[model samples]
Target: MSGIIGKKIGMTSIYGADGRNVACTVIEAGPCVVTQVKNEATDGYKAIQLSYDERKDKNTPKALKGHFAKAKTTPKKKVVEFRDFREEFEGQVKIGDKIMVGEVFKEAEFLDAIGTSKGKGFQGVVKRHGFAGVGEATHGQHNRLRAPGSIGACSFPSRVFKGIRMAGRTGGDRVKVINLQIMKIMPEKNLIVVSGSVPGAKNSYVILEK
Candidate 1:
């Protein structure tokens, strides 16, 4: 499906046509430049590589700088690839094609959002692994609260079972939520406000796919 790379510019509420306040995630979508185009014959697939957010030439890498040079555009901060584009969209989108959010997605009722989730660091089984911590709170349970309790049988396995639930790091992973409705599309400022909360913290890079 065709899509574009964008940034989560924060969130706000706007009134829908039904006169109800709808929570929306404001995103600074495209104005994304086509950095490369892949085909089955050449790259073994069909996709469009896009770049967003301009940066100083001195800060960009030599390979990326050359890639941008081929596209005839300045250096960009982020680059992403979209796969399986249609024939109509193929010729229209070439290297150096600047696809704004409005042009690519207009009146789009739904979208699929891909982003990195916020990190929560290391956590316990009660919070991280959802293990039912010691339930008793009044049976003389002084310090055993929020514990994983007995892990396994005494002598059957003689060792703690592998793949046992335990405390560990949480979040900071790639998450993709589908069917997010597009509330509004602003071409002038290259903004797309989507309904509901998207993954990741504010200002994080998000991919909005159709």
Candidate 2:
């Protein structure tokens, strides 16, 4: 799949031609720089590595400094590789080439957005796994409201199941939202407005793919 790295620039509602307001997420889909090009002969695979956003030289590691120097670009905050990019780019994209938002996506095109969901830290089963509470608060049920009722049977299994849903860390996982419609494209601002919401918080990086 061909994709571009972008930052979620919050969201807004725009009035459509039918006089209906539609909610959309604004993303700053780059001008991403081609940092590296891998080939089947050398790297054992074909892929194009793209770099987006900028980082200061002082904060960049020594090894990454040389890596970005090879591409003749500044240290990037995010780097991602996409296989089969040559088919979409017609085999013209090389190292140091810049890919803009308008070049990859068009208005009204359906695409997929991949991003890390917002972390909610340690959470209970009620919020994490959507486990319903243990009935009403009657019958002297003091603290059993949000508790996960009986994980395992008595001596039948003798132990809790491995895949049992429990309270634990939530979110902060890679999530893919598919078939998002690109409602508008602002080439000058390097922004693409996609219908509906995307994962992650505002300003977080996301991959928009087609």
Candidate 3:
């Protein structure tokens, strides 16, 4: 389904009608400009390329400046393509058309969100790979607290297995968390509050899909 490009604006809790606080992820959803409109007859698919977050023209490259010039719009910090739109989108828009959050997902709830997860750099076996670690706390054990115990048999295999879980980089990958209830949509401020936390750090780019 078609979606809007957005940024995760931290998290906060709000009270509901039931007098209960609902944890939510506040996002700055698009007031995106339709940079390019693609169709089956031309691009072999029906899709819209939306540009969000304005940037200074001087900061943008000359080639990209001309690209934005074609749309008759200012340079943008990010651009993304969305496909599988509703039938109402058929020939309804063109390049340089501004698509605000109000235009598309008005009064929407239960949306699917996608973003890159927070990066946990250089994690160890106990944290990253979830190893048992050392197995004991005492019994004259010196300092084998967080080690991967017994990787292989004595001499049968002689070499460690290929697919063994070990310490490495963690997180910073694309993640999609779905079925989150949209508690509020502040079109005036181009903000959306959804019930529950989403992947990624604050100010990171996120995609909200139907």
Candidate 4:
């Protein structure tokens, strides 16, 4: 799918034409630079690499500095590739081209927003996996309220099985919200207002695909 790199610029509510308040997420989408163009003949696949956001030259590594120099652009904070870009833009896009949000997306179009969810650090099974705790507060159930009952079969298998839902890490995973409606497009500000919520915290980067 073809898409653009964007940043979540928080969220807000807007009055719709039907006099209803709609919640939307504001995203600073694109003005992304085409950093590299991969072709089947050379890279064994077809994909277009895009770079978004700016990074100071001093903070960028030497190798990456050289890579950005090839595209005649400054160091970027985020770089991602999209395979099988839209057919209309296939032969038109080349290295150093800038793709803006307004050029790619339109209001009312359905899109998929991909981003990393907010991290909740280490968590227990009750909060992490939504496990219903040990029934009632009776039968002398002390700290067994949030415990994960039995882990495995005892005498038969003799060992704990793999893929058991347990408490560990929570959130901070790649999440994709599908069928999000593009409510509005602000071309001058390079912002796209999307209906409903998106993954990740405010100001985090997200990819919008169609």
Index of the highest-TM-score prediction: 2
True lDDT of residue 175, candidate 4: 100
Cα deviation of 119 in candidate 4 (Å)? 0.8
Model 4 global lDDT (CA atoms, 0 to 1): 0.94
Q: For model 1, name the residue pairs that clash.
A: none
- Residue 45 lDDT in model 1? 90
Sort all candidates by lDDT, best to worst.
Answer: 4, 2, 1, 3
Candidate 1 residue lDDT tens string, 48-87: 9999988999998999889899999999998998898655
- TM-scores of all candidate predictions against the true structure: 0.92, 0.96, 0.91, 0.94
Clashes of 1: 0
**Candidate 4: where is the Cα deviation over 4 Å?**
16-19
Give the better candidate number (2 or 3) by TM-score. 2
lDDT at residue 17 of model 4 (Cα atoms): 73
Whole-model lDDT values for every prediction? 0.89, 0.93, 0.88, 0.94
**lDDT (10s digit) by residue, model 2, range 140-206:** 9999999999899988989998989999999999999999999999999999999999999999999
- Which stretches of model 2 miss by more than 4 angstroms? 17-19, 86-88
Which window of 10 residues has the lowest lDDT sum in candidate 3?
101-110
| Candidate 4, 13-83: lDDT as tens digits | 88777889999999999899999999899999889999999999999999999999999999999999999
- The candidate that achieves the highest lDDT relative to the unseen native structure: 4
Candidate 3: misplaced stretches above 4 Å?
A: 154-156
RMSD, each candidate, Å? 1.7, 1.2, 1.8, 1.4
